[model samples]
Target chain A: MTEPILSLRQVNKSFGPAHVLKDVDFNAYPGEVMALVGDNGAGKSTLTKCIGGIHPIDSGSYEFDGRPVRVHEPRDASALGIEIVYQDLALCDNLDIVQNMFLGREERSGMVLDRASMEERALQTLAGLSVRTVTSVRQRVASLSGGQRQTVAIARAVLWNSKVVILDEPTAALGVAQTKQVLDLVRRLADAGLAVILISHNMNDVLSVADRISALYLGRMAAEVRRADIDHTRIVELITTGRSGDLGLAPEQTGETGDPDATPAAGGSDPAGEADAIRPGDAIGPVVEPAGPAETPTATDTDDEVPA
Target chain B: MTSVTPEAPQLDGPAEKPAVGGPRRSPADELKGHLQAYTARVRGGDMGSLPAALGLVVLCAVFGTLRPAFLTAGNFANLFTQGAVITTIAMGLIFVLLLGEIDLSAGFASGVAGAVLAVTLTKHGWPLPVALAATIVTGVVIGLVLGTLVARVGIPSFVVTLGGFLAFQGVVLIIIGQGGNIPITNETVLAIQNNNLSPALGWVLFALVAAGYAATRVLVARSRRRKGLDTEPLVVSAVKVAGVVAITAAAVAVLNEERSRNVMVVSLKGVPIVVPVIVVLLALGTFVLGYTRYGLHIYAVGGNAEAARRAGIKVARIRTSVFVICSTMAAVAGIFAASRANSVDPNAGGSNTLLYAVGAAVIGGTSLFGGRGRIVDAVVGGAVVAVIDNGMGLLGYSSGVKFVVTGLVLVVAAGVDALSRRRAAASGA
Candidate 1:
């Protein structure tokens, strides 16, 4: 990760002694979508907040673009080109699109709001990001669909020239079509040369868009798996079991995969190709969720490629 | 870059963007596709005073038919002059209401300022305008203290303003002392309410207001069209302007109505000049709440104060300013009322005056719950209350009857505010 856009090393946070984040290390490289996967209470949000400048880490530090940095507030994070669109979206429903987009920093020529300039800039920002679903930028957020609101929030962050964009569950509330729109937007944000950190519990989204995936288990980073090295099945297994002993990285590598290094390449084009670099067979390592009866992970799943 | 479909239509695309006129674009055609994309949204649903405006018109007719003399030029002039003070105070109250608070001290503060002015100007022979300025400043100081307590100290506005109400009423008594009636011998100040703007000036002033309204509507509509921004239909704008002009012309005609009496010839008093003054105040208040970001911050504070604060608005300052405006307007109303009566009694602005101020705002469709309502609501609703008082008095209804009617109107108006709030909340505003 040649001078990653943002790096959080040994970050620790606690609320008076109820340890929340414990020595968390995370890094996001420019132009790559990294998934921060975790179970409930795994401190994913806490770790992100530390990076977002919403919380001060009890220990460790953050480095941005090769220099150690201090982010004491969201404004600091913003000035450092870091932007986070939290789950709530923080939009004023009474305000129109242009107003909501520029809630904190309004563009003014003098004493008056330069409505024409703001509207023009907002439209340009949205267009530059290839956001097309929204018809009227003057419409209130209350009238927007969930996908459109998410798009607006994401567009607002990118419009500020943010170098690192963090999105917490951008598609958590969307339906099928809407989710597709948001996932598409996520891809474009990274492609536009901004490092994207996506926090989601959904495996399909992680599999579809993430270039790299880091899983958090019990307040510690369990593993950071490059997306090319693991498919959805292996990723879910690691998320659920903290290891994929019984489930090989893929069916093609299932038999005689004692040495991952011995294998030439695991389908070079696929996201699982990087996971194939994991040195195999050294330690199966006391993993949880041993294949058991009454635990069929695949049967009841509705999301694409995610088992029950 | 991955799965974004170009087939998806652009919602807020600019016409001149991406080089216009080259391939008849969907984004361009889509811009032509009309939608109810924008509305000023000063009020949503039933939060405004269309009902109150209609009620005002009907109340006048009913009173006129019942007493016949109730709609005479002299009585109508009396109604407008009376409504002016309440409307003025309610305009101030609108600001406090926008910040989701109430100022119980307004009535007493109003009395205190008027008493202060009377003592300084008429009794001590201080320069009239200077004395008035001193009195208004005192009112502002009192307001500043209350505002500081409510905003900086984090004391609830209810407790702070309630304390102010008691303290200021005591102060008013101290100012008035043993003086039973303070005669405002100032002739120039009396003209604001006592004398009309002379019928020609009155009519011309009203015509300018009408023209102003028309020009503003046209300008706004043209600006929206020029920007290719979505706004209400042009016909809606025209109809709204036409409605104002019609109302102005009708009011002037009504003031021009004459009644022939056995004792003397009666003709409409030709629009009390105070009407235009009241109109100007309402317009100023509307402008502050509409075009300015300060107005936007007020709505944001009222809607969800925590959200507004997090958005970095100076909520405390905005909240303090609102209370100050409210109290200052109350002082303005006090002085206006004193001039209208041509004399100021020691106990002039009693509990009833404050109650009527609250009632005017509430009945005008201002939500007592706050975050909603318009200053114009007070103008229309104050007109209704004044019409009722004058018409009922002319019909020989006793003061007791007036009290009962006023109480009933307050209860009904508050009930409406509650119901409308419940509906809006249910609809997820």
Candidate 2:
């Protein structure tokens, strides 16, 4: 019902010869959590990087707030109110929370840093996020736990009045309780009218908080489905086989013919055929190992369609 | 259980209350909290300047007990001048060391700068200001070259500076040809390390420094309070100010006492001019590292260059600028060295000069691993090194024994640094 704050159409990215992201379309609406899920090398990171302007896309139309734009660097993205909280958090361990929050963009009076203002603003931002675990704003980041560091990183992203906040594995290293805290924070971000793009490997995390789920398989977007319409098994099938039931890429476009340029066939015709290919053991076994290393893309794609 | 939606009122309700460690408690409770926090930090392996402070106290007690003359007013004055060159050089080295980079050429770099000063003033008959400017420019040029090579060319700082260490020694040797030394005849130039401030001026300087420090602390606390942010307790600020005043007053009082053995002759009863110079440098360095954006960027880059880069900081520029600051300070130290000896010699910044400077920085609690050091660390560590050197000399120990002892002391200081680093890693601090 609401228009996407950030939209990417037919996005293509290549790292030299490795076509990391191929015609991947993505969209994130305001006040919604769009969880981008994919297996390893499914171009989740590449897609995020392209959106964050860390990588220049080979060809794509990037629209932000309905305006077509070209982003060549991280500064351009941030200037448009887009921030990425990287997997490693990208925080200076030696600096305290306030210092890390305003590392490069420090508030200054003449030539001197305005410490009180920075501290006050940092406090407000953290408070606004409902972050209660951190004891002090002056405690160095090195002294913070993994979850606290994640909180600081997320707070730093939101401090700039960012419209789109992309989180890369925010809770991959966190414990169970920490994961819950972060997931709650993610929900809060979307509720506050910020488009939050959460990239995660854990299915439970996606199921719990994400309003929409977009799964990528072998650099192609397999499907973008509303969370209410998808079950656990269908999402798994899309991630592994690139197709689930009548949704996702048609059977031929799953790459059994080793054609990299095959156009996605909108929707599948045979629901019975797709259902027969939904066995977890058979689907996952062939997808894990490919026969030829030189033809990695084709080999992996052909292997993905073996069970189907 | 209630279905806690993101729109829950509980979130905003608690946020309206103070979230930074809660509201300020009573004075006693605040003090207890401060003490407990400090203790926890120390236990967590953030030792900071604790080891250096303890070492200074122990060394002073031992030396004063064994060598009564080590506590004399004259030797006390000697400590400031004796440590002045090494301390100045070490202060510069702290910048390079803060980036986890080494400048082996710093010692020889100083020697070359001194040679430039000697040549410009004595050989070319340049004015004092011109000579000083020339010497400083020489240092800047050297820094630009070394920094460019390291930051742009991607050479490791250790390798680039080691090459500089050897090359600059040759340059120094070439500049001071035929005669082994060039004696400085300029009264002003020679007086930097030899002259002293008037007794009245020393106390005036002390008063000014103490007042400035106190005012700064009070103003900062007042500003924080006005903003309704958590401020340090009044007692803590007062205690810190008092500590600074007491140390300064004691030093000034001792230096103001007549220490000339025979008072009828020349009265050497004032703080050394170099003392004020070092103090000014320390203040400037501390201000840059603590209160400036450039300094914050330096720390960020040192802590994690990748993170700094991501934060839009110019990592290469920060790296280059630190080397420039370091080499400029080295030039100042070289000028002081020339002033102290009343001449520039081939060995001006050679022998154990670089080692002494590096040792002073490390001994002061500056981490060799980078991202954690203060300018004051160099000053304190310089005092420890000077005391050891002066005390051993007063006790009539031979240079060989002194060298061995000083070497061992350096190793021990380095060991403390490594062990503390390991402790910090283990504690995840």
For all candidates in order, the CA lDDT equals: 0.72, 0.84
Q: Please give the range of 10 consecutive residues that has the lowest summed lDDT in model 2 chain B.
A: B1-10
lDDT by residue (tens digit), candidate 1, B278-336: 88888888877866677777877776676567667888898888988888888888888
- Model 1, runs deviating above 4 Å: A1-3, A127-135, A143-148, A172-181, A231-308, B1-47, B253-273
Q: Each candidate's interface RMSD, rounded to one decimal? A: 7.2, 7.5
Question: Which pairs clash inside model 2?
Answer: none
* Candidate 2: stretches off by over 4 Å: A260-297, A300-308, B1-18
Task: Indicate the docking level reached by candidate 1.
Answer: incorrect
What local lDDT does model 2 show for residue A268?
18
Candidate 2's TM-score reads 0.92
